[model samples]
Target: MDVAGAPRRFTGQYYEQGRDIFTDVDQNTFKAVGEEPVSTFSIDVDTASYGFVRASLNRNVLPTPDAVRTEEMVNYFRYKYPAPASREQPFSTTVNVFPSPWTEGRKLVRVGIKGYELPSASLPRANLVFLIDTSGSMNAPNKLPLVKQSMLMLLGRLDADDHVAIVTYAGNAGTALPPTPVREKARIAAVIETLGAGGSTAGAEGIRQAYELAAQNLDPDGVNRVILATDGDFNVGITNSEELKGYVEREREKGVLLSVLGFGMGNYNDALMQTLAQNGNGNAAYIDTINEARKTLLDEATSTLFPIAKDVKIQVEFNPATVAEYRLIGYETRMLKREDFENDKVDAGDVGSGQAVTALYEIVPVGGPRAFGERRYGTRITEAARGNDTEYGFVKIRYKRLDSPTSRLLSTPIDRTKEVASFDSAPRDARFATAVASFAELLRGGRYTGSMTYDDVLKILGKTRGDDAFGYRSEFDQLVRRAKTASSMARLGS
Candidate 1:
C-alpha cells in the first residue's frame, strides 16, 4: 500500500534477492511485489516495522506472506541506556532526546526496544541447542539456509565456555551435534553446512531431543534453552496443539526453556509459535532475514537468552474513588485475574537483566465532567483489594527468582498530578514508550481516546526524537513522512 506519493528510504538499508521482489509504485515509493507479480517474496526483518512490505501481485501469482510480526518489529527498536540499579560501582546514565513527531502531512511512529545493559558480572554461562527445520519446505532462501547463517551470527556472540548444541527435524529428529563449547567454531560451522532439505517436519521429536540435551548439559545457574528455528508449520508427529503444549510444559519443569525463533513465510502459524513460546517459558520472534538474526543474537542477546526475573506479573488496582474506568493498552493478552497475580502457578512475562518493560493505561475520570459514562454503578468493591483512596491505582509487580516458586512484590503509586505531558517532557525511555503506545493505538483503530491519526502520531514522535544515537528515532521520522504521503494519496484515490 502506497502511503506517500512515492516510497522513501529510511535509516536502515534494504536488501532483495536479485532486486526481484521490489517494485517502484510511484515517485519514490517501492513495494515488494515478488517475481512475476506473485504475492509471496523473500523478506528481511529488522528492528523497525517488522521489516515487512505488504502488497498484491499484478497477475495470477499468489503473494507469499511475510512472517515478521510488528510486535517483534517494535521490540527490535533501539533504546537509550539507563542507570544500572546498583550505585556502588554500578553503571548509570541519564538520556534525553528532542521531540520530532509527524508534521503537516508526514506521519511518524516511535516504537522502543527500551534501554537494556548487560553487566558482565551478571552474564550467565549458556547451554543453547539450535533445533533447525531441514524439511523440503525450508528450501526457500529465507528458510532453512537462512537459519544456518543466522545461527552462525549467533555463534559469534557466545563466550568460550558457553555450550552450543544442534538438532534437526525432517523425517525424524536427531542430535546433529552434542553440546559443544563456543570456542569450537570450526566444528559447529561444519555441522551447519552439512544441513539440507529432504524429509517432512518432525517438530515434536526435534524439540524432545533438544530438551533432553539441554537437561543433560543444564546450566543450573545459567541460561539453558532450545532455540527452535522453523517456518512454524509443524506436521509429522505430535502436530496437535494440546500434545505439543503438554510436552513443552513437562520439559519446562526440568528447567529447560525454549526460544521459538521463526523463519521464512507461507503457511506461517503465528498462533502456534506464540503458544509454544508462552508455554515453553520463552519468547517467540520471526526473522525475515540475516540482519535480524544479528540483532537478536548480538545486540539483544542477553535479553533473549537469560532471564533476570521470571514469572513477572503486573497488577494495578484502580481506586474507585479516584478513577472511574481504565483500560490497559497492548497487553490485553498479558492481563491476569486479580487472584492470578497471587497464584504462583500462573506464568507471566520474563524480564531479562537490565531489560525495562513499560505499560500504559488510559483512564477516564471518575465522577468528573469528562467521564466516559458509568462502567460500575455503586457496585460493592471486592475484598481482595488494596488502597486507601489516595491515588489512581497501586502498581504492583510480582516476580520470582529464576528457579524459585515464592514471588516478590514491588509496589509504586501513580500520583495524579505527575502527569507526563508530551513525549519530550518524559524521560527518554518513557517518551519512547509513549511513541509505541501511540503507534499501537493507530494500528488497532484507536479504540480509546487519543487514537491520533498518522499525522498526529508523527507530531508526537518528531517532538520526542532523542539523540539519533541508534538512528532509530531518526528512522521513525522518515516513516512518518512516507506514511503521511501514502495516506494522502490513498484518500485522493478514493
Candidate 2:
C-alpha cells in the first residue's frame, strides 16, 4: 500500500511496519591484561531487554538473539547493595570476586553501585510531557490502551504541585493538553482517554514538538522530562535513529530530558528508542503487562523520575601480575574508549535514586587457563613487582552531580580482600547477579558460557533468589521454565 520513499498511512484495517528491529550484539571477547589492561564502559540500568525476552518466551518462542542484551537483563533484577551515607556522594560502590558458576578456573568479579534514595517529602516538583504515539501501528490492545493505563499509574506517584502535558504524533504532531497541575488530575485523565490511533507515524516531528513545549515550561528547580510512549515504529519523516539521536542530544542541553516507555511487538523499534533514551539523559523501560507497569512506574517511581547523577562512566584496570585475561560479561553496546572515561564532554549514562547497577567480569588469574591460548616462547609469568601482587585491579568511577557540569571521581582497589573462598560464601546479591548474567549468556546461545544449560540456571536461581517480596524472581523462575519448554518445542520442529 506504500511506495519505497513514501510514508505509510492507515488503510481499511491497518498498514504498519510489520517487523521488529533490534541492533545485533556481538558478545565481548577476552582481552589479555598485558595487551589491553583497562576496560571502560558506561553504566546501563535499562530493563527493556528482559521484559521483551519474557514476552517472547510467553508466546512459546525464543527471542531473536539480537534482542537479548545481557546487561539490561541482569540489571532488571533488584540487588541489596549498601546505600550511600549521604547525598554528597550520592551512591556507594561495592565489589565481590567469586568463583565462576559455569566455567572452571575463571573468577567472576561483581561491581555493584547503589544510589541513595530521596525521601518523598524531600523530592522536587516535576514537569512531564507525555509524548504519546497514536499511529495506526498502536491500534493493538497492548499498545495505546496499555500506554494510557501506564500514564495514570505514573501519575499516582507525582506530587500535587507536579504539572503534566500531553503531546501526540500520528500523521503530524500536536499538543493534546496544555501544562496543568496535578490538582486538575481528572481533566488530564479525560484528555488521555480521548486519544485515538491512526495515520502515518510522525515520530521525529512529535519529538520536536514535545521538546518545544517542555522548554516553554521547563522546571529548572525540579525535573523537566518528555516521556515518549510508543511501539517505536517511526515510519514517516526523519525516521533515521541517528538523526533523532542528535536532536534528543541537543534538546537535553536545554534541561528537558527524555525517557522512553516501549510497548507492543511485531513493529517495535528498540534500536531507535535506545538511541533517543541514551542520548537524552534518561533511562528506558518496557511495559509488557500491568504488573510490569506498576513495577516500573509505581514501585520504582523515586528512582525512575529523579536522577541523582549523570554521565556516569566506569574504568577498570587489570593488573597483569594478578589477572592474566578478563572480559566484561555484558555491556557490549556501552563500551567506551579508555580516554572517554576522563573526558567530561563525552556523554554517558545517568544513575537514579535508589537504583542499583551491576557489572560482571570473567577473569583468569595469573598462570591460569587462558581462553586466548598459551603464549608462544613460554615466557616467564611472575615478573611483576611484589607490591602489586595483592590487587587484581583498580576501579575508577566518574559521575556528575545531577545539576553540576563538572564530574566527580570514586575509586577503589578490587583485591583479594573482596574475594570469597567459595561461590556460595559470596554476598547473596552478588551470587544472584552472577546467576542472571549466566542465564542471559545462555539465552544468547551460550557462546561464552560453557556447557551451561537451563537446569544450571535454575539451580543458581533456587539459591540466590533472596527475599523476593515483589515476586519478580518467582516470575523469572516461571519464565525460565517456559524458555525450556520453548527450546524443546523448537528442537522438535513442533
> TM-score per candidate, in order?
0.75, 0.94
The TM-score of predicted model 1 comes to 0.75
lDDT, candidates in the order shown? 0.58, 0.86
> Per-residue alpha-carbon lDDT of model 1 for 138-164, expressed as tens digits?
888888888888898889888989999
> Candidate 2 at residue 455, lDDT?
88
What is the Å distance of residue 480 in model 2 from its true position?
Answer: 0.8
At residue 49, what lDDT does model 2 achieve?
94
